[model samples]
Target: MILHLVSSPPQINLDLTDCVSNSESDATLQHNCLHVTGSIDKETDSRQFISYCMNEYSPKWNIQSNSRERKFTFVELYKHNITSRHLYLWSAPMDVAERYQFYLDQLSISNEASMATQLFYNCTPPRFGPICQYAFDDYRPDHLSLNEIIHDFYLHGYEPTTLTCYVHLQCDRGPAPACLDWSEICDGKVDCLDGGRDEEHCWQLEANECADDQYRCVNGQCIPYTFFRDNTAIPDCLDGSDEYFESKDKRANCKIAESVFECEDLTCTIGHRSWASPLTSSCAQSRSDLLIKAMFLHKPNSVLDECWSAFLCIIHGSNPSDTICGDFCVGQTFNHERKTVRSSYGIKIEF
Candidate 1:
């Protein structure tokens, strides 16, 4: 509740504890009034001073000095709004008030318009926007002091500094600044428009094993773990290993989605390809022949479509398109820069 009045006006300093009445009924009401003089100062709009006080403390008392006479007058501040009863007034320490006056006067004369915008626009620190109109509810706390706020402005300008992710993500420098996410870096995709800086050091990814939350493609591209077996026609890996359903290379590495049910019985195996496995009668009882034909009959362009559609039918006796399959079957590569989470459901599937 410490207030730093920007305009120089000699104010009477009174402790809130002293303002409380001896009467038990009025003590709480008087105690609450101890902190509000500071509240009007916190608001950026100076015009709100009277209206805010009237709306806040409707049952008002006017203290005036008339030529050596001390007079107390009671007035109805807000004639229409009588229900609002809460109002309080508090004073700042002399030291804090003096410091605020000094800084306000100094900043008002600065060459840079932005330097004094906070004072001129009537907005407090950490409260930014046009005319200091917007601020987070938690931006100003009751305990914060004006000196500490001024120090903050000096240490890190009036506004918060925006950090650029390009440096952290190792993106190439371009005319327009570009930012990349950690997932997009070395994920078998080029995100930076300048020179594909995101994919520059991808050779390191091929050499190193992926993290627990990531999946390594055949070409050694590390993508989000959920990207594996995402049920999309378009591949997550550069080599299309994630979507290479039944491809020998896919099963050779033992990289498979948990959703996929691998048939254990060798008696029902029709194809020798590691990735190509059809649900056999031994695994289940229904549609064994039709599943085999769907897996082997057509050399579909996207292995994702054939296996997902057939597997869903075998497992649940339902088409994947109607239930679990993704909307994409267009074989188009996604722009990783614009889209952070490439998968429809961005959740990690743990084995």
Candidate 2:
């Protein structure tokens, strides 16, 4: 059996190698120590033996056996709740403290110890002393911890100075000047800068009175309708502006004569005598006599001269004496003879 002492300052690891088949004997021999028996080569199987000793023996130190070697060798430590200030001892056939020291030296040189130290320092609290009010108030870990610190500062009503500086720079720039030009060129007025009296002059058509259809202005003169067609039929102008007045008057008189004395029947009355008689003269003789008298009155020749004056007088409503009628009958003697021959032959004659 082996006896070992366990302390409280630093945690200790147990070694399981001896006290295999003599577990009961070793337990009775070491009164205050724990006993372990197991094949340490199989670590999982050895844990059962270690668990059994830890549960049954409530000692601070114990020993384990090696089954393959058939020898009792290693020591084990078993503590209820160890802290960093605890210490433990081992009693065995060999110097177990030296073995523990050698084991600790190997552990100290391992990569796990260095990594554990880094993690431990990283989790330690900051040195803010009594000012640390919250649980994580003084907990900072370089760059990672500084990010959380700044975030918390903003949460606790801390405003950065850069924001105020930016606002002040904007105000110092000031408002821009007004770019309006008050010259007449851009003031909605027509500016005559090129020496003209007005900007632009316009011409418009004449007034409504100048467009009258009855009085058209020709060559700046107001000519009446007679001057337009040059017709002498009548003075179409009420003012008689046409120069051929005599010709217009004669034409007017002829139109009047044609309107008043146009032949309506076979016989016509000329100063109480029928100038175209169908009884005393045949129809042909009467028509011939009237045609001859009309021609003589219109254009009188030397043969028609003696009767022309009387015929004109009768046509103008003058009374013809018996002597004028005798002269007219003498001029119509051939026409009377042809009418007598047509009457004797029983032939109907027409003018």
Candidate 3:
């Protein structure tokens, strides 16, 4: 079970179109997974080993065998898109789990980075004999161990869920990385703790209804630029994120009123509010208190019992979503002149 992927890359030329014709049913390996062999216990180490084979090891295959062949690579497991767990999960022969146990043994040798180089060498388990033909093309060694290595790096202090948008989440919240799922964008609540990076340029993904001269950010607002970055002096997108790489010098020296603010356990500087717009109605009241504690785990922007300000709509029992900015919720309050408005029309409603 040793993988010698250093001096030379492993040969990944396997065409198992006939052998593994029906992945779920034809998996002779899967049937054998129940009859655990070797010192490896099925209950304890199987999960990680299975993840390694299905996620780390399989993606290396070149995948030209057939439609079913494409379905078996470990890459599918990386994205969490599939549910079937132990179909072809064996490392050696169907009756033996020694190779898988060896994989776990290597992991215990050291942290991901310092593991024994011998683990990188290629040694096909007996079950691989059938599917080895399915592995067409030279095996590109994951020298970085990107496949075998653990991925809990917490990329940029966010919870690292395949970061398609990296610059948008530059640690406005705290040390733990916040995962940026594209689905979360424009979904109503400001899930990203960064001022408004998650919501910027959201309208672009929707059907076209924008002006020719202006561009749109996710917030559904129109500005004087067409695309995200049009070489403009200032960022047309409200979240300064669009111009992040363009104007490094100006961003190095930003000026905010206080230049610093504190929210609960987190202390933030003006830099933390890079995308905040003080004059704009949408962001005018953006305060340090806006950064909620991630420990809540309810979702981003979950409200606390104490009100940050009466101006926020939550004080008036308006939380359209679990949490939203106060201004967006307040709209035009029924109260008049900061006082209760007495009306002759009385309507009673039941919850």
The CA lDDT of each predicted structure is 0.34, 0.26, 0.31
Q: Tell me the lDDT of model 2 at 138.
A: 36
Model 1, range 1-351, lDDT digits (tens) per residue?
222334222122212322335454452233221112212222322211111101123134343322321211111211222111111111332222333344445545763333222211222444322122233333335325433332233334222122223345545422222234343455444556557776786787568798999988775668898868874433556445676443334332222111012212111223334333332212222223333333333333433554434333434435445533333222332212221111111111111
TM-score comparison, 2 vs 3, better candidate: 3
lDDT of 1: 0.34
Highest TM-score against the true fold, candidate: 3
Which candidate has the highest lDDT of all?
1
Worst 10 residues of 2 by lDDT: 115-124
Residue 227 local lDDT, model 2: 46
> Residue 21 of candidate 1: its Cα lDDT?
51
| Candidate 2 Cα misplacement greater than 4 A, ranges | 1-234, 245-249, 256-351
C-alpha lDDT of candidate 3 relative to the true structure = 0.31
Task: Please provide the root mean square deviation of candidate 3 (C-alpha atoms, Å).
Answer: 21.8
lDDT of 2: 0.26
